[model samples]
Target chain A: MMREIDADKVAETISGLLQEGCYRLSDDVIHALKLAHEREESPPARHVLGKLLENAEVAARDKVPLCQDTGMAVVFLELGQDVHIVGGDLYKAVQEGTRRATTQGYLRKSVVDRPFSARINTEDNTPAVVHTTIVPGEKLKITALSKGFGSENMSKIAMLPPAKGRSGVIDFVVACVDEAGANPCPPVIVGVGIGGTVEKCMLLAKEALLRRVGDPHPDAEIAELESEILKRINDLGIGAMGYGGRITALAVHVEVFPTHIASLPVAVNLQCHSVRHREAVL
Target chain B: MKNNMPIARAITLPLSDEVLKTLHTGDELLLTGVMYVGRDAAHKRMIETLEAGEALPVDLKGQVIYFMGPTPARPGKAVGSAGPTSSYRMDTYSPRLIAAGLKGMIGKGMRSGVVKKSMKKYKAVYLGAIGGAGALISRSIKKVDVVAYEDLGTEALRRIEVRDFPVTVVNDIYGGDLYQEGRSQYRIADLRR
Candidate 1:
């Protein structure tokens, strides 16, 4: 049996969260940008970085959007088995909340009706990408990660042979980022999903990005490997915005999922310096 | 040495090969005067026009082209949140522009092979603006007019005049790449031990 919660309350909360998240860059993200600016070496890259810092400062001061691509809102929900979502529909509540936020939040309505023709703005940012999973708890936990297309476009999934092992995974990810170079905006957060099916790997990689920066991997051996890989990625000298530097990657996160004995699917999700995400539980 | 240069008022100046050559990798520029705005769509059209041996909508002789797709302006604004889009997408179309007297590019990121080759050969410079800084950048623009491709909406071509628009020289006339130069200076050899 699930206990019911007020739908209007949930909608209000979701709407506020969406607007706040879209309008402001997270503190962690701001800190990372500052750190990147301090560490950047190339004069040109540093100049550009200073501008980015100034932009963030101005945006924050003015209460304006940090980036034009407010991004497609992606909500990860963990529904409590004991809690019932009441009053109207859950998806509609979320969509309406997003719509309200997009309009009032002053976010750009990026979603279009059709892919090819009659491409028109959805007016309000509706139809947010929602992923829900049932959990054992009594609380409904929601996490949102706003993603822009530039960094998202650089995501990669590779079906590597099991024999190639971990080194191969590192190679593939580094190669992808290298090819992506300055395009994805370097000083990136790399999330690696290993040992899952192709689609699962992709999802897992994105999920891994939600992890805190600089947290060590739980598995000791894997932690050591991750450290080594991070060192190498930074060594690629992709730097800030691909201006060559030692801090190309701020952190590398790896998540593993069960896979077929013969297959190892690896996915790399590169997040830019502006990784905007927030979470709340109710 | 750069610290000595006084921060001046933002002003819009015309785009020309001469004005372009005066810029170096770390120079701060407030661009105005005459320049065409284009991105992927406009590039395709420009290339098609070139192939057809037809004159482009805007003359290319000694012009600088900005790579940007801006948000729709608020009521009665010249443009809205206009910022540079990615430059790499225009890599294939750049050499032609340089040959057609396109002397400068404004955008972020790196270009490869022929684009770099063309910049060096044609004496053009690639200026880098901060990515994700659209709102701040838009403040510098005082005027904008649609020159072509209105159907493309944000991706349409426009002529914009900006005052004290900030940019860093990423690719220089001598073939210097600032992106490569910046990272090698700060990357640590090892993180553990």
Candidate 2:
């Protein structure tokens, strides 16, 4: 017999996650920042990192957002095939959760109605960028991430010919960070997605960031690549807030998928040190 | 060689040429006094108003403009998390504002070459605030009022009074750029050599 879960429960869980994600820096991310601060050689970069740590502490204590750009909510849902959602439309329920969280949490309403023409504020930060997948278990997993555009604006995607392979991927990812320079805010967390189709590659890259900081991919080869890419990025000397330092990037997370023989799509997604994300299961 | 330890300076707004000349790229500053808040939309509207030969909402003569769009304040708070936005978006309009006697700007990221040249030409300074440190930064703001374009919501023009608001000199009137100088200092190529 399949299990039934109340949509209200999901909504409430999402609301809490949204509020928590914005106010608190995840433990792993905080740890990474502290490590970066200690390792940073540039005094300015060290000072900036110290300020960021202090800011996080203030936001947590005061129950306020860590940054003014509380960011667009990006929700990742993993639903079980055996579970049935009851009492409300799934999408509407999630949107309502986001609305409630933004309002009750006193977070900023940053969503605009139209891209180019009308350009009106949505007021409640609604219509979250939601990605859903169906899986085997009876439990539903939800991860909420507040993605600030400063780093999102710096993301890049390129479809490389298969022959270019690993070197091509390395060069592209490094160049993206170099070009981004100070704009995305550093020390940054880089998410690299390799293989898959173009859109899938981009999603993979974003999802890669959901991994806890300092955790490496299970695959040895991929983990090695992650370390290499991370070292190269830090070597760029973009530093904290681009003030220059030894530790520009705290970590580089990579996600891979099988791809067609003709194509090797690579996407690089950068996250500022704020790195706000939280997860809940119901 | 520039010292690794950032030299701390205290500055007040409506900056003077003598004060501007003394600032160097990479110096840390505790800024105090009033500043106008404006972003891309506000800049565009201001520029349009200028082209129409109409008076700007806020006078540009000897004042600092902070590039930010703050979150709405909670009931008891002066303002919500208010932090600097990227300044490059204002590249087109800034030179005109500098020409109109704007003395300083607070924002993150780099400015265009034209904007830098104009800052040097007009004796203006560009200050950088920590990008994601909004909540902490907001604590420095003691007062806020919507000066113009309330309809713009978060993008509305705001007049805010701050005390010891933290920032760093990213671009100075002497053609110095902290982003370039700082990064070049730690680049792997140079460090290896």
Candidate 3:
């Protein structure tokens, strides 16, 4: 017998998560920022980090958004194979949840109907970037991230020849950060996706950002790569808000997937220090 | 311990040449007075209006423009969480505004080379407000009014009066860029023994 999960319940859970996620900075992110603040040698960098931490506190205390952008809603769902959703369409439920969350939370409506030509506001911030995967369980897991476009616009990808290898990946990622400079709001958290097809690699890069800051990849070799890439990036001296400082990046999270023998696809997804995300299991 | 103290300077808007000359890269500032808001959509329209040989919605002479699109204000709040957007998107429009007597810009990120050149040529400065510190920054914004292009929603032009709003000098009239100066000061190669 399959477990029957009401779509409304999922919607409600997601709505609550969205409100909380937008208002509250996660502990790991807060911790990493505080650590960065302590370690930062530049006075301006330290001052900016101090203000960011204070901003997080004000948003949490006042029940307001951490940043005005509030961002386009990106939802990651793990649907259980044994669970049957009832009462409504799952996607529609998610949209409904997002609509209520934005209205109730006072989040910004950032989505537009078309990229070019029309450029009409969607108003409710609907049609979230939903990525759903099937898993073997009865529970549905959802993660909601408020992805601000300031950093989103800075994200990039490239296909390197296989022979370039690790050094190639490091150089490309660092170069991306160097080019981004202050635009993406430095003291940035870098997410790297290595291998996989073009699209899959980009997704992997974004998904890597969901990991807690300072948490190393489970694989030792990949973890070392994360550290190396991070060191090179901070070495660029972009610092806080590109004002220059010792701490340009808070952490680098890398996620890898198997790819074609001929392809070494890499993607760099940058996240601002705000780093708003929340998850719920229904 | 000695380097930890930031050099704080207070400035009033509608910036004069004296103020512009005093500003240098890396100086922290708290700004007070009235400023106008505009973003990409408004900028495009402003340029179109300029091309038509018509006046802008607001006179930009001797004024500052903040690159931002704010969240809607709830009841009892002056404005919603207002913060700076990236500055590069406004690069094309900024030179024209600078030529029209715009003296300063507030936003996060680096300016394009063309925009920086215009700043130096026209005696302007670019200040950086904390990118993600919307709520904190909003406290300093005491008044707000929609001045133009209301249909643009958040992208609409706003006339705002701010008090002690925090910012840092990113680019100054002397052709100094804080982004380059800051990076070079702490680059790993410079720090390595």
Candidate 4:
């Protein structure tokens, strides 16, 4: 059963998601923030969290950007095997969506054309980093994450020897957060990728973030690993915005994949307290 | 213990070295008056202009600069979601600006040792605004003007007037660092449970 979906619809949907993602934070983050506010023992970190809650409200109510960076738009597309696209090319449509959203949503044009020399703004925040996957359903899923570089820069990937095993992975992720300190903006949601080749490991770490905040993985062993990592990370006492307190991370999500017998690759992707993302099914 | 948290002071800009001497890391403040806003691109251009032996677009002497680039102002507003960005990216250019008599900076994150030394030598200060709280912070900005590098889009250099803007002293001229002091005060000794 093949369904023809218009490419314009994809663009329009993505544009809307980007605007909404920028204006208001998703509910999961809001809920976790409120919980952190209550659980936090330090007055300073608590106060900062309260202000962040107010910021979220103000942004949503007044339709203002939650953060100035607005970030590079990273979109994940899951195209159903049975769907056919009409009206335009798929990849071009995604870029068009990013461009329109940048203009209409008042997002900052943060993308640069060159990293090495004479770096220039792309002007429209176009050419979004798109990751596509072919899936078995009739519905296409598009998820957009506004990735701020403060945290993105702090993220790390390490190729570990298989002999080091689980504890090494745990230590690396925790050490990354410790070194990151307040720079990534605390109370960050950490995404961990383990057991794949390097690039796949990085992608898996990002994909792990798409899961609802604080939701443990389904597999019992994986879910336990998530809990263990979350505990160690929060134990750093980096606290909200690194003001230092009881809770530094709202959640830690981990995703795992089979890899070469000799390779053990792990990646960490940190999302700031303003974890702005949205998804649509078409 | 709570008394260590300094009461928020009302500060007017062009902060004198004598006044900066009294401030310490972790002191809260509400700032007023004009300040220039610059980010990665604007700072790069300003540094290039300086290195090229040309006068900067604005005189940094005895001035405060905010490391930020706000979103486009909504209709009728002065600016949109004006908040501090990470300051480390500007570290290389900061010491030179401090030497040029820049008095203060508003941004988040830690500063490199070189930048801290410059702050001490130049008698300047570094303040941290609450990161990711831009919407709440923007309400303090009362006026805005594109002072230079307008083509940089959001990274353009802008002159802004803020009233009762909230900030905290992250690095003081006396070598006190709030990020270090604050984090150390709360870091749990136990690495794991």
The model with the greatest DockQ is 3
Taking all chains together, the TM-score of candidate 4 against the true structure is: 0.97
lDDT per residue as tens, model 4, B1-193: 2633467899988788778988887788999999999988898899999999999999989999999988888889888888789899999999999998899999988889999999998899999999999899999999999989888878888888999999888888889887776677777776343
Q: Which runs in model 3 stand beyond 4 Å of their true positions?
A: B190-193
> What tens digits encode model 3's per-residue C-alpha lDDT throughout A1-282?
799999899889888988898888899989999998989888888889999999999889877688989999899999999999999999999999999988888888888898787778888889788999999999899999889999999999999999989989998999999999999998899999999999999999999999999999999999999999999998898898887777889999999999898979999999999898899888
Instruction: Please give the interface root mean square deviation for model 3, in Å.
Output: 1.7
Give the alpha-carbon lDDT of every model: 0.75, 0.90, 0.90, 0.89
| Deviation in Å, model 2, residue B29 alpha carbon | 1.0
Model 1 chain A, poorest ten-residue lDDT window?
Answer: A40-49
- Compose the digit string of candidate 2's lDDT tens values, residues B56-167: 9889799999999887788898998888888888999999999998999999988899999999998899999999999899999999999999988888888999999999
- Cα lDDT for residue A86, candidate 4: 90
lDDT of 1 by residue, A1-282 (tens): 667876676677677777676557677667776776787655545655677777777666655666767777888888888987788787787787777767766666667778587666676767788889999978888777777767888899999999988788888887888788888876688888997778789989999888877677898977777787787787777766665655677788888888998888999988876676777888
Cα lDDT tens digits, model 4, A148-201, are 888899999999999989989999999999999889988899999997889999
Look at candidate 3 and give me any clashing residue pairs.
none
RMSD of each: 3.7, 1.6, 1.7, 1.4
Off by over 4 Å in 1: A6-12, A112-126, B1-12, B26-28, B32-35, B45-61, B72-80, B145-148, B180-193
Cα TM-score of candidate 1: 0.86
Q: What share of the true interface contacts does each candidate keep?
A: 0.49, 0.67, 0.82, 0.65
Docking class of 4: medium
